[model samples]
Target: MTIAHQPLFKLCYDEPYLQGTLIERNNRFLCHVLLDGSPVSCHVPNTSRLTELLVPGAPVGILKASNPNRKTAYDLVTVEYKGTTVNLDSNLPNRFTQLLIEHNYFPEFRELKLLKPESTYLDSRFDFYWERESFLAKKDPASEPVNGNSCLYQADTLTENKFAGYIEVKGVNYVENGIAQFPGAPTIRGVKHLHTLMDAYDQGFDAAVIFIIQRSDAHIFRPHETMDPLFAATLRQAAAHGIKLLTASMVVQGKCVTPTLEGPTIDLNPV
Candidate 1:
């Protein structure tokens, strides 16, 4: 997937309201520039989740819409804090991103697995699994070829008829100015999830922390170090421990959104 005809907008710091003022009117708002210097606005749709982070003087990314009837002139997209502009309202975006990487539909993924309590422990049924295997096939003249090939037969590649590894998925919503960031707010739960992935790696299972970035403009992704330092630290630890850290972005197609992984990984080593 590709981002076509991305509009270029400016950071209107000259305007009085743009100069670190809050949105007092009904539909207006101030957004922040992302880590990559992109404009974003915290609009009404995102107000409930963004109000706390979008305080005065918060730098944001703004996209000027061509539609005159739209309530706000600019879309409030992200907020900058502690030298980082956290992308607010990333929930839906994250979901779309995950779909691109894993190719799992939203509905299928939700009901794909359930955790059942077994002996005081919650056992989770993973969404997917992976492994490396070699194929052993024999030529049979009477066999019909699969996919228009008449000579060979394709078969499942596994050992003892069981999967070799298990993996879980997590969606991410956080971006600014086309640059994706995670945890629009400080998320203790996110930190815990990283720890869980680390645990899975230790327990001989292949695990990953997937960030599905919502916005098409984000060229890259990073963890929100400013919002939650602990989460960042744990993410680094997860990487070091071999919990594959992955990311994918979403493509807006008409009224629908699709996930696509093309953005580079964010490196936030503790510094």
Candidate 2:
């Protein structure tokens, strides 16, 4: 599908982001940055390894914490790498997916309204719970048409009935050679999410996982088999079970995050 370049979400800050240079990562959630020649602690929003993006002396954009009582006064939000601004916020993908669904960006999500965010299933809380308006209505055999023009019917071949489903969103920042990949490090939680989606599909509900590449340079997306072989294997299994795998790339310019005109294609199996 072709979509015009439009800002889906804006990264707003009450105070202007401070320009800084990376010093070192103290831990998974904390890092030290040289702001104005002085080293200061900053909060890292993502838990991934990010070895490619968070190298020492790399330029970064950090936002000061709103709360005065916070231990770390700044949050590292963006990293400049090879002329591309990569957003490091792990929470932004869900928001982007929500906006995309509201805008009817995905054909499978057409006519489907978001019922709730962070909706819970058996053992996992999904990013979204969505249902079609017709799904809530009583099923009528007489009202059903022999053939339909809706793309939902054509895309999802599981059921003729209306769509209702759970979606899990993943934010990807690691890209190499124009290919975006997820789980920069091993993630047990990521594997669990795939299992939850497969279980949802078995329960007769539409289940999907949407990966939002947090950079514009990527031409396609694939599971990081080398980083986390277990997660990659499970993702392949989920796709075989009819769980939808969706992806899109975004361009981050300053504070505005916009979707590219052409979305990234998914490559489940990659050499």
Candidate 3:
């Protein structure tokens, strides 16, 4: 009915677009493409190491730039490999998850109030912060409002403990075989976030890290250990210390996509 009560955004990239073959990635943000057999420069939205997905001659989907003065006339939207589409925009994952959580799509996070966006904790700024308050019954006799599928009501409440939560979102595009891995390149920032989450978890707060796999090809999720073993080790330690790790895959429909979470098997100290 209202914007605040709206549903989670469904995957839908419903726009006038073009199909092209990727010719070459000039750098992190620019790629040469063959559109209708004519060479053109396209903007690659996600700068991560697209490892196996951005092979030359791969089918790519692009959205025409509305800005006439822009250097590149198209924004590379998706790369198709064996019928799978990866959202090439690194910027969309966090915003998409925010839409999901605000619309109560996540069962684990539903009813948890969205306190702030880009909340800072120590040196890191998280994607979100939610409040989870548990009231004391003996201290009061009246009821208060609550939201959840399980604990939708609270009665005879008094001030008790309120926990602040943090969510860090990671966009995952690099998949090997059937497994999705992150940090397609070495990331000093990612390692720092894992350690921060672990520290927050130890500080009596609910802390979590979410990996939004940009495509559906991955059957499992793990750290790209071979690429960044230090980060992988830190992530493993965080999980062992009770920091919540979530893996959700996007269901992309022509650029419109919603996330679907899956169970993860995170292996650290792998043999």
Candidate 4:
């Protein structure tokens, strides 16, 4: 695929994000921030243990919660670090990747015509399910060419004879010395995803895991062996088994986030 000179995706909020100072993190999903000189509880969007980024008195950006029934009145989304804005939202990576696939950003997915998000395979639910146009046309010659606007084909309806692929997406925010690493905390589910991808590859289906680094400062991507050795080992095993491992860096400007034209290089070697 050609280099993307434009923004891959833009995450706009309904209201302007509020600037605040982070006080402390209470748990995985909760934090306290000083907004407008008042301490208020804010919802943390990420589940990972962001130990490095959630320091006390750190500058942060938050948005007002739209749901009236919600407990927290604001959601912490962005953190300023070393002159770079790092996005902490865990849900943005999948949406960003969906836009990338729709635009044919990855060469491996150029031939694929349709995309289904949150697709189930076996006991795991992958982030994306892609179908090739040629395969769809050959399966049903009377049907029109499959496009993004067409209805999504159910995974249950698809058989092994179909040509398709599965993609799992991971979001990254932790960076050290210009290297982006994944899984700030130990994650059992992450290792499971890697194993599932390997299983799909063994079954003759294309499988890949894309890591979206939510900061532009990272020049390379690698697994955080110190933080989670199991996850790192599984990632290496998946790579050895022919599962595609990809990484991309994103730049955050004000309230908008965009992918860089040139993606980051992946390094599987232990640090």
Instruction: Give the candidates in order of lDDT, highest first.
Output: 4, 2, 3, 1
Position 64, candidate 2: lDDT: 84
Give residue 107's lDDT in candidate 2 (0 to 100): 86
RMSD of each: 13.1, 6.5, 7.9, 4.8
State the lDDT of candidate 4 residue by residue for 1-271, as single tens digits. 8764767666666756889999999999999999989999999989889888999999999988888799998999999998889999898899888877777788888867778888776678889988887556545434443233243333333466546778999999999889999888899999999998888777667799999999899988999999999999999999999899988878887567877876789999987
Query: Which lDDT values do the candidates have, in the order given?
Result: 0.47, 0.81, 0.74, 0.84
Error of 1 at 42 (Å): 15
The TM-scores, one per candidate, come to 0.48, 0.87, 0.81, 0.88
Residue 48 local lDDT, model 3: 81
lDDT of 2 by residue, 201-234 (tens): 8766789999999999999888998999999899
Q: How many angstroms is residue 46 displaced in model 1 relative to the true structure, after the best TM-score fit?
A: 7.8
Candidate 1 regions off by >4 Å?
Answer: 1-48, 51-170
Clashing residue pairs, backbone N/CA/C < 3 A, model 3: 11-256, 11-257, 12-256, 12-257, 13-255, 13-256, 142-156
Q: How many residue pairs clash in each candidate?
A: 22, 0, 7, 0
Candidate 3 segments whose C-alpha is farther than 4 A from its true place: 1-9, 13-15, 133-162, 261-271
Better of 2 and 3 by lDDT: 2
> Any idea what lDDT model 2 has?
0.81
Q: Candidate 2 — which residues are off by over 4 angstroms?
A: 1-15, 139-162
Candidate 3 global TM-score: 0.81
For residue 192, model 2's alpha carbon misses the true position, in angstroms, by 1.5
Candidate ranking under TM-score, highest first, comes to 4, 2, 3, 1
Residue runs of model 4 more than 4 Å from their true location after superposition: 1-5, 140-162
